[model samples]
Target chain A: MQQFKTLKDLPEQDYFTGGSSACAGCGPSMGLKLALKVLGPETIIVNASGCMTLLPLYPNTPLKASWIHNAIENASSTAAGARHGLDMLGNKDMNVVVYAGDGATYDIGLASLSAVAAKNERIIYICYNNQSFGNTGFQWSTATPYGSETKTTPRGKNNPTGTTAVNKDMVKIMGAHRVYAATASLAYPVDFLNKLSRAKERDGFSYIELLGACTAGWNYDPRLTIRISKLAVRCGMWPMYEIENGILTLNKDFSELKPIDEFLKLQGRYRALPQDGVDRLQVLINEHWAELKEYNGQRYV
Target chain B: MKQTLVTGNEAAAWGARLVRPNYIPTFPITPQTECIETLARWSADGELPGTYFDRMESEHSVMSAAVGAAAVGARVFTASSSQGLLLMHEVLYIAAGMRLPIVMATISRGLSAPVTLWSDHNDFLDQRDSGWLMFHAENNQEVLDMMLQAYRIAEDPRVLLPAMVNMDGYVLSFTDEPITIPSPEMVEEFLPEYNPDHTIAKGRPVTVGPPVLDEYTIFRAQNHVAARNALEVMEEVMDDFDRIFDRRYHLVDEFMLDDAELVLVTQGSMSTTAKAAIMEMREEEGIKVGLLRLRVIRPWPAKAIAEALKGAKAVAVIDRNLAPGRGGIMFPEIVETLYHLDRRPLVSSFVVGLGGNPQTEHKVKEITRKLIDDLETGRPRVEWNDL
Candidate 1:
């Protein structure tokens, strides 16, 4: 993979438009723009039904690359078909990439995506993880982190915590499939682009889940999207990491990780988090961080 | 053409192989498994060059992948049966709404609740409203012929729609019959290479199957127009198919319709048994009963159905499927078509086979005798014959 020195190293030819109907400071829109920079126009974007489905709302689209939206839960399999379709047409240089949502990736589309990873089809799957079903007014999804409030997981008299279940360790699941799996953040464009470049270099399946911080769902200031993303990594919440061919690599490592309070307080979903909830979240993050450090630069799965 | 003994599954696979599709996405289900197994073996042996045989996890993914491949302008073929066909029902509309010309072989089986692995028309007719061109075959020869014709009719510029060529399960799928497999050279001359203009391609960026509000009506109307276009396109396709292959097929199959007072309307392989009964009734019983087998079901073939039944005194619409409260699924469709005719014959509905309860010559004779009774009484009856 060719490493870019800085953000300016991105090519001038962009395939994605700057803005559309998406909320201001949408992390997924940024992730898409950056990913398109690496993928270019010789690619087909297989989109699932989500917020991104509106990107091509009848008679209008912002993409210079070809796109197909099959359904909500079959983006991975659709990409598999597109990949084989191109290969059969004797156009192997083109890329097949998927842009799905957290609800699509972590829940409804899991089986479809797992089949692709198992087959090791030549495709790239990008899951824009906003932690909930943000398209449907912030409903709880399997990707929703613990202690976070969503429409379906509202805290009431009987329930002290909004969501009690932990987020899925998706990167580990893909790593076990022995393919290229990674976690990226909107705050780290260089890291995400670098991972995408590496994924393009491989001739098999790749899963890259980006931390798509939602302004409306998370109830944060539009201007603080990048800051919140940065804090997520600094607080050991969203780690900048990649697992390739069973080898784990931690991209951003902090000697003294910041406290989780700074990251939680910025978003309204975590505003009502109790002291005990914060303590439990911290313990979980610390344990995961310790495990990553131990397995760094080694076979992790 | 080479005359060989093969099952309906093998015939469908041979059709796919002769067409040389760019991709085939498949999953295994009983009665349809052998079709994909043949493709898989050929793919492993490197017989299918420039083609990718993909094995997907489920029928839904199989069809999803077919849509993805076809959206990129690659020819695709797949097969499924019963519950698998039900699972693929959602994407079938998407394939047609997007106007992707994909072809699939549907081996019909009864729907599950008791889970019978036998042939019935419920699985095939359930997709009647799905905006796909539908065809049913009576023998292994027609199975292969219809598949080749399906691609021609589906991929025409005037009709960029998907098609499903159906044959009865167990009876046709597993049983062997002599079919002439057309040569690849003849198939090439008959069906041209699929060069679709409405798809995703390099330097031609497009968004397929996007969301729309009120504009949804216009797109759906286009799907309807295109499927209706298949009615005309298929006439030309059948002509070309006959000119090259020396075999003929019409929108509706007519057997002994001339100078007949009683007619039986049927579909799939049961038409063969009904035809045998008609000959016996003509020779001994002095009954002028004929048969009308529905070969082309969608773009409904109403005019031909009316033309064939125009002279009959009473018509019996023998359905191999039961729609619960509704008598026979095709009963209303046939009745509605003939309602406008000047001499509208008395139409009776008979729901016969449910889960491969055999449709025999005696059952066909009984159905004809009942139609004679309806003709005498001037009243139509809806009865379950096989019960």
Candidate 2:
């Protein structure tokens, strides 16, 4: 993997072109730009129906490499097919990647993702986790954190906490299939790029969950996309970790973690949550962090 | 060519093997499972070299993978039936809209309510407007022959569309019949290696199946034009096939339609029983009856149907599947086909043999008798044959 000391040290050329259909301060778009920089133009991307699909509308595309936009829930399987087709065409070294969204990866597309991982298909599956269904007017998704207000889970006068469901543990699910699984955040470009480069070097069924922030869905300031992403990891809401070949490794070990309230107060989705609700969310995050530390054979903080 | 006794499922499997597709993404479903198992076995035993066999998670994924492979310039094949076909219904439109020439074999079976494992046209008829070219086979031979021809018709530049060859589930999928398997060299001569112009590769960076909002209408119109062009392409391929194998197939096979007063329009294996019924009606009862079997359901043979039934006194459409409130599935299609005729014959829809119920010759003769009776009064336009 190529080591980059700073943003200036990265490749000058961009595979993800400019003037995309994404809105201002789109974290997923930034993640895609970085990903294309690492994977290069020799890759064929299979994009499931989501915000990423909306980026390259017909007659206009922002990709310099080959891309296939398919139905909502078949990115992983379609990438598997592209892998097989490339092999049949005697181009075994060409990379096939699936760039999808949180709703597609964690909910609708999980079956296909699991199936491909079971076959150990040589494809990198990346889920741009924006917490909610960002493309469809901010509906609650399986990756949406508890107490977040979405179109489907609007905080009413009687129920001020919005959604009561916790976020699904997708990295652990992929890890259970014995594939290489990792979590990265757009706020940390170096770490994200490093993880992507490492994932590209792996042989089969590599998965990365990129913490993508949605300024429109979360009702945050457009300029605070990277700030909120950083707060998410700093507050232990989104931990950066990797599970390679059944061994867990935490990438970022904060000396003093920020309070979860600092992350929750930044987004309008969690504005209706009471003090107790924030405390409950912090407890859940602490429990998950302790479980990860246990998996790493370290004493719980 | 060598003669082998096999079921329709086996015949379809043999046809796929002869075509030697580069990729096959399939899932197991009843009656269609035999086809997948046979292909898997052949692939495992080294009989099908250079082929990538993908046992997909579901029928939806099966078609999704097939679309992926086909879009990347690979000749792909898959099979399903009934519920599985319904599961793949959404991607069916994707395959056609993307202009991927993926050939699929569907063993036609009844849809569930009270769940049946028998044969019906409901499964195939439900996908009528999905923009896929549909071919209905009567016997094991036609199953084998059409499976090979479908790939050529779909991959034709003028008609780049996905196609499905449908055979009755129990009637043909389980029944054994002697079929002449074509040689590999002959099949290779018929269908050369697939080379797609619009494919996703290293040198060519194409965005396949992109969202086209403003120009979506033009894309849809192009798909319809391609589907209509398939009629000519299908005939041309059948002509070449006839010249090579000495077996001819028409869009609509007519039997004793000349100087006939009554005609029966049918499809699938029921056409054989209708043919037998017409013979008996002509011999014993002196009724001037004939049979018109629809070989291709999509890009319907509207002109040939109008010509065949132009001077008839009445036409009876035997629908093995019902469309609920709308009566028979093909009745309205045939009625619309002959709507422009000056002296149109009386058309009646007869719903029979639904949910895999047997369609015997005796029941078919009863349907013809009902059509003859309707010619006098013309009271009911549609009737249940044995209900």
Candidate 3:
């Protein structure tokens, strides 16, 4: 992971074109842009059907590199084939990357991701966690945080807890396979770029989950996409960490974490969460952070 | 050439081994599991050199991986059956629309609600309009031969579409039959190395499966044109194959149909029984009954089918799979093919061999006798060969 003193030190090449159909202040777009910046032009992107599928609609596409849009749940498997195919063609230098969404990654595509990791396929898989199915008008997905208001988990007059289920820990699941798994955010471009670069340099299966903020889905102002993401990590809602070769390293260490309400109140989805719900969520976050801390700079026994 | 007694599944594996595909992404499914097992064993024994083999989690992943490999300029192969084929249904259209030229072997079997693992065309017929060139093999020999020809047809520049070579589930998949295995040099001359014009490489960038709005119709129309062009391309490939290997193939094979008044149209393994019935009807019964076996169903082979059944008084389509209320699936297709003829033959449907029941020679002869009677009676448009 290389560090740049300034933003201008980054490469000038743009693999992701400007005219994308993504919404304004799209966090996933920024993550994709930065990831591609590190990956450069010698890469083939296997994108699952999601918001990214809409980027290249019809004859027009915003991808400057060779890209394929596969079914929602098979991006990892598709990229595995692409890597093997490229290897068979004697073009081992080309990188095969899977750009997928949370619904495709944490839910329907988890089996494929697990299989790819088990097989140790040489490819980079990036999951843009937008909390819900943003492409289909914000249905409740497994990655959606507890108590988040979604189409399927609407906050009704009778039911106060919008979504009772907690968000799936995909990073830890990938860690179980002992593959290089990391968590990054668009809010921290430099850190995100560093992790993305390191993931690109790895040989076998590598996974990175990027915290992507959705303006319409979360009912947040389009201008605060990066601010909301930063608040998420600052309040201990989303941790910044990496697990490489069974060794876990916490990228952002905070002695005193901010309250969860400061992050929850910023989004409309969590507005109806009761005081008790917030307290319980805070306790869960604290316990999760403590568990993650044990792995900081430690190897799995 | 070496002759070996092997099942259809083993023949399919031999065909793939001879082709030396760069990648094989497959999952095990009943009747088709042996094919993948053979491939895995070959890969372990170092017999499959330079091939990347993976047992995918599901049929969907299998097809997806094959698509990815094909898109990256690799010759790919995969196999599925029954539920497995249905699982891969969605990716089938993508494979053809992208024109990746991946080859798959499907062991025809009945779909499950009752969980029957038997020979039937329900699984194969369900994917009729999936934009893939489909070929049905009558025996293990054709299974081995068609597997080799499928690549040549699919990779043809004029017809860059995915192809499926289908053999009946247990009848061919498990039944042992004598087949000639071609040498590596012979197969090399038959199917030259797959050199794709376009791929997802670093320097060559292309957007595969991009959304198509107003131009969707044109792309679909072009696919139809390409699919139709496969008929000619297949004919040329088969001619070349015959010239090299001395084995002839036809889109629709005819047996004793030159002076017959009744023809029993069949597909898959049932065609062998139909041929035997034709022999018995001609020699012992003194009935001029013939057999018409459909080899390629995708480009429809309407011209060849209609031409073969032109002089016949009536045609009895012995479909091993039923289409529920619509009678035998192939019956209507054959009737539709001969609709514009000046004197169209009367076509009757007979459904048999559902759920792997044997289509015995006696049953086929009964269907032939019914066809002979129907030439004058014109009664019972559809009948089922009762178990």
Candidate 4:
């Protein structure tokens, strides 16, 4: 994985196109490009209706591989078909990748996805979690952080709890399936690409949840997207790790973790928070990081 | 080539074997399960190299695996029956809509709920509009023949759509019949190895599916029309098969429908029984009741069907499966296919023998009498038999 320093270091074939409907500096699109670079072109990508769906257009779908435009709730099943078809054809040297939005993968397509993982179908499924349904206007998604305001979740003084529930732990949910499951950050392209490469080589179901920075939905400056993306991993807000057959392998351990404010203050979605509000978020982040550290340290023994 | 007595299910499995598919994903469903198991055995024996045999959790996953593999440019095969086919409903459309040539064999069985595993066309008939090319076989030989033809037509660059080759469960799948096994060399000549030029290329980059606006969506959807090109390609393949292997399949087969006052429409195994009954009636009382077997269901072939029953006074469609409140499933489709003809013949539908109930030749003979009697008396009410 380290041998490939950049997308340019790999094959000249760029699977994800440069221009599309995705917002400028959208982290998900960049992550998608890097992900495809690792999987290569002998791949069939199944995409649910999302920003990615609209980003790639005719004559120039940001993909250099076979692709299917699946319904929001059926991307997992659609990719399952691609996996099944590939195996039946005696073509063992290719990969099937399914990409979906948080709203699609977590809220709606979860059952279908669970079915695939339970069967352990040979394929790679990626969920680009922007924390909201950005495709059909910014709406609340299961992955939406505890304190966030969207068209659906309007900010009101009385509604102290910005969201009703805690963030859905997709990595943990997928990890429980006993297949390869990992969390990647758009801020860390190399690590994201490395996990994806390993996922491609491994048989059975492998999943990656990418915390992609949504420039439009998050209401952040286009140029600050990468910086904000990087801040997520730096603040220990988004831990980078992998779980292989129930064995947790922490990819990166942030020793001098920055204050959570560095990541949350930058995004307009969370800009309404005051100093005390920010402190509460920091405490929650610390609690999650400690839990992950304990989980990663313990082995089957 | 060595000749063997095999059922339609075995023939389909053997035909699949010749292609040397890489992956065989399937579930254990009646009638179709034998075909999947046969492939599983071949895959396990290493008779075919570099193949992956998957015991899919469900029929949906079976088709899902096929779509995924086909996208990555794998030649794939699978078989399913009534309930399994219905379960795989959504993925079926995705496979065809994506323009992947995934060839599948379906042994038709009645859909469940008072479950019985017997021969019925209701399973495949329900999915007549999923954009996959549909073909029915009246016997074991056609099963083998259509399987080969399906690969040729489906893989054609002009018609990159999935296709289903259907034969009746128990009736054709279990009944032993002498089949003419074409020499592998002849089959190779008739149907070449599937080589898809427009596939996922590692060296170059191209997007296969991207979002399109309204008009472009329709434009992209016109691939369904492009698939219509296979109608002629199917005919040409049949012509070539006749030239080399001495077997010809009419897109729609007709039996004595000409010069007959009453015509009976049926599919799959029932067509075979209807043919026997027509022959028996011709021998006994010389009653002129003929049979029209619909071989191609999708792309309906409306004009061909109308032309086949042009001079007939009445057409009785024996639907072995019900559409619930709507009599027989095929009956309505057959009637709809010829509704535009000026002075169209009286079309009648009968919903009978559901849930795999055996439709004996006596039932067809009884149907012939009812249809003939109704044609003479001009009965206003359509017959709905619950046999």
Candidate 5:
């Protein structure tokens, strides 16, 4: 057992170490670091094929904790197995957390994760939504925003296509399972950590949607990763909220929604949008915010 | 020293009860449901302690919840058949890939569309490459015994892979026979409480299921190799079981194969009929005949099959399931196992008893008798379509 010096005084040896192949200032890396810090040494993680997987399993990497690499679509199931292994060994005090990308969580892994969460199995599932399949070179994902210029969605289209399909409402979808579900952001460390800590204390399945930034794929200045993250929440593009036992609570009250362009302009993935395209994107964002507002819940902002 | 008539399904449940896993996530399905119901009843009666009986919504969820519970370092158990196994197809690969030693009982049933709740090898046969140690039980005794042995084999450090113990639906699963049930205390002595060397439990933390690239598939492959190596441990565990319970089973059981010209290789409940047919041919016709019952299918027990049939002039593999255009599913594996070997015997493939069609004593006799005639005629058909 190691001693904790400060909250960030993490193991001297990181749970997710440096030298990972992740581009500089990847929010998923920092999010993982903070998650391990709070989860302590008594946690096991299940990761999927995304930036998190690429970096962690990169050659000659220094890893402080034990890990299993599962398929992108089955992290929750894999983590569930690890959790059961822990219980078999009489380690009921352990935390089993599965970290997946937006593609894995919102699309392929959606059904299995939903089933496990609905059963309220004791586990933590964190969907690190980088908005696209960054490991595969910025392909548009189900979580990709409208008018975002991804490898597939090269030019932000004014006309609706399949690419314009609404980003899956995973947080609410998971919430509907009556398990603990929350949307968090890497930029909001205090709020993110608080939710993560609370998730750890829960006895059943809990999920936190992490608004992670992919520095390379998103074509952003790595240093502005935190800024991009905060802009997303402030703009109502990525709301900070939690749902516990079917009751939703806003982590950041959206009293005055910021323009979505501020968040869009930070990443090159959304740079192809023309003026009218930005207006359409904002309209969509506004419509989504209206629904968030009408959702009968206590505002925490 | 008491004997009670037990079906393969009952024995599976009895076997699970002996191990006393921490959780059993199960959804009721034909043949396989009894395996979990017995465990649930035991859990309710205090016969099994500290075990969670999760009645999940679907087979997918059953395996999913078991995976989650097992992820937290819990010894988990579940049972399913046919469509249920197919429902868990995705997670089955994940479990093996993640190196979670989750033990599940799969009662073999034909796959669906024209779904029938009858005995067939197609269920587990289709999943042969999913990287799980597949054990086919030939009788109620082996079904019960394999359930106990599967844990030791799957949990072995060399083979930290999930395993499926398969019994033919209705045939062995529903059929009752006298099975010696080991005392829980005795089983605890035989297979101690599962203490995983690597688990993401409370004090000791680890990350399971990280991502791997195509090149890093070697890591996953190595895990599979490790699972294959666990077959040796199965032999040791069975030996230990024999010493304690006085029943014997070869990882691949062979009967009267020495100096034989023809050998019939089969698995699951059909092997019993095959053995009877081989005996009848040997006694009445004076034909040199024998039967090789495959107990372990995942690792394929190629070495055992090869060694047992070494001196035989010809070997015929009787499969209850087809691989479609290719003929018997098990035949190709057996052929591949012996393909590179020096001095291999003539191997014939025959597909029979699909979609729960009974492989009666007559079918086995007809197949083996034909193989004998072909050996004598010197023109044995290596592949035959299902009759």
Candidate 6:
């Protein structure tokens, strides 16, 4: 695995190029681009049915690496097959990575993902989570944070809280499988690339759920994609952490978390959030942050 | 060649072992569990040196892994029955659409509403439109032989499609019968190393099963054409199988069809019972009865079927599967195939032996007598024999 300590140390050759229908400053697309720098061209990107599935409009694909789109809930199982197949064919050096969405990873494809992780197969799995089912016009998913408003969870007269369900902790769920699990942000390229390198080096399943801050779904300025992503990490909403061999390590430590209001105010998805909802969300974030801090450098899950 | 007493599940496992599939992703299901168990035992004992026998969480993942493995140019094999086959239904089409040559053993069982773990064609026949080259076997020997032929035909460049070799559950899967397990060297001579030019490997960048717009119809047409192409590939594979192992097979198996005026169209293990009844009728009752067993269901052997039943005055289509309001599934297919012939046989529909109902010789003779009556009346009947 090639170590890239800084942005300048990263490889210059790009495998994911221009020419798709991806939204401007598409965080998932950027995550994939940086992932290819770590994975290189000798990789097979197993994609599930989601927004990125529409990346390759017929006869045209931005990815130089091989891509396999199996179905809505089978990117992990499909990647498992590709990894085993390549290994049996004596081409064991090539990478078989899955690039799926939150809907695929946290919801539909969760069983497939857990089974593969339990087996400790040598494959890198990346969940490009944009918070909601962003492809389907911002429908709420289990990954959707509380107080956020997706189309399905609209702030109406009956329900003012909008998204009431607590967000699923994907990192803890994956770490419980005894495989390397981490969280990445599009704002931090070097950290994500370094985690990608670590996942590449492991001869077992490694999961990295990268926060893909959506421009279209979140109704944010395309230019604020990075700012929103950075705010997510700094505000303790989306922590930068990794769990290796049951030990959790905080990648970005802070003296105090920034206010969650700035992160919520930037996205239209949270514009309808009331004062009480905002306070509730802040309490939830603080509670989660406390747990992570207590478990830091300790055996997690 | 070694003649040994084995179950149909063992026969399938032997076929997979002889062909030396590099990957065998499996999940346990009734009637199909022993097949994977045998492979798992071999993998554990180090008897299968190059094989990776992986036990998956479900049949869906088993097939998904198979597609992944086959897409990367590895010979892949798996087995399932009833609901297990249904669970893998979605990926089966994807496997065919991707043109991955995966050979799977489908041990047929009755579908559930009220579940039965016995032999039936519903589970197998339900996958008729999945774009797989379908082969149903009469006995354990044919079960093993078709597995060898399935790989040969599927891997052919013209075909490049997945194949499902099915045998009835319990009767074939658990019951023991004498079969000649072909030598590994013979299978090696017959099936070449799987080296697909379309797979994904190092330094070879290609997209598979990508989203297509107008080209969706084109890919579907190609799927249909490739399956149709397997009709020719079957002949070549049959010839090679005969030359290598001296076991001759055909797209449609015929028994006493030359001088017979009464014919019974059957499939799977029930054909053996039907053939026995036909012989007793020929000797005692003096009824000139024969049987035409449908081996290949997909890429339906329409020509062979028409020619086989051309001379018959009446044909009884005995189906071990039912289509609810639509009588027997194969009854329509047979009638459709014979429609263009100059002299079509009087084909009657008979749905029987569902959910492993014992397909006794008594029922066979009764069906033959019904066919005789239908011929005399010159009017066909659609009836369920169990009633």
TM-score of chain A of each: 0.98, 0.96, 0.96, 0.93, 0.90, 0.99
**Model 1 TM-score, all chains together:** 0.99
lDDT of the structure predicted as candidate 1: 0.92
Model 2: interface root-mean-square deviation in Å: 0.9
Clash pairs, model 1 backbone: none
The sequence of per-residue lDDT tens digits that candidate 4 reaches over residues A16-37 is 7756678887878877787877
Clashing pairs in 6: none
* Candidate 3 CAPRI level: medium
Q: Write the per-residue lDDT of candidate 3 for residues A1-301, one digit (tens) a residue.
A: 5655567767888888867999998988888888888888888889998888888887777777888887898998888888888898798989898999999999999898899998888899899999998899999889998888999999888878888899988898898898999999887888888777777777888998999899989998899998999998998899999888788899999998999998989899998898887888898899889988877899842
TM-score-better candidate, 3 vs 5: 3
Q: What TM-score do all the candidates reach, one by one?
A: 0.99, 0.98, 0.98, 0.86, 0.88, 0.99
For residues B117-206, write the lDDT of model 1, one tens digit per residue. 999999999999999999999999999999999999999999999999999999999999998999999999999899998888877777
Show where candidate 1 strays beyond 4 Å.
none
Number of backbone collisions per candidate, in order? 0, 0, 1, 28, 45, 0
User: lDDT of model 2 at residue B340?
Assistant: 97
Better of 4 and 5 by TM-score: 5
The 10-residue segment of model 1 chain B with minimum total lDDT is: B200-209
User: For residues B249-287, what per-residue lDDT tens digits would candidate 4 score against the true structure?
Assistant: 777899988788889888877788788889999999899
Candidate 3 ranges beyond 4 A from true positions: A1-8, A299-301
Steric clash pairs (candidate 3): A58-B211
In candidate 6, how many Å is residue A219 off? Answer: 1.1
User: How good is the docking of model 6, as DockQ?
Assistant: 0.82
Q: Candidate 3 lDDT, tens digit per residue, B228-264? A: 9999998999999999999999888999999989888
lDDT of 2 at A260: 95
Off by over 4 Å in 4: A1-17, A36-46, A62-98, A107-125, A139-141, A147-163, A173-180, A193-206, A219-224, A244-246, A251-286, B5-7, B112-119, B214-221, B336-343
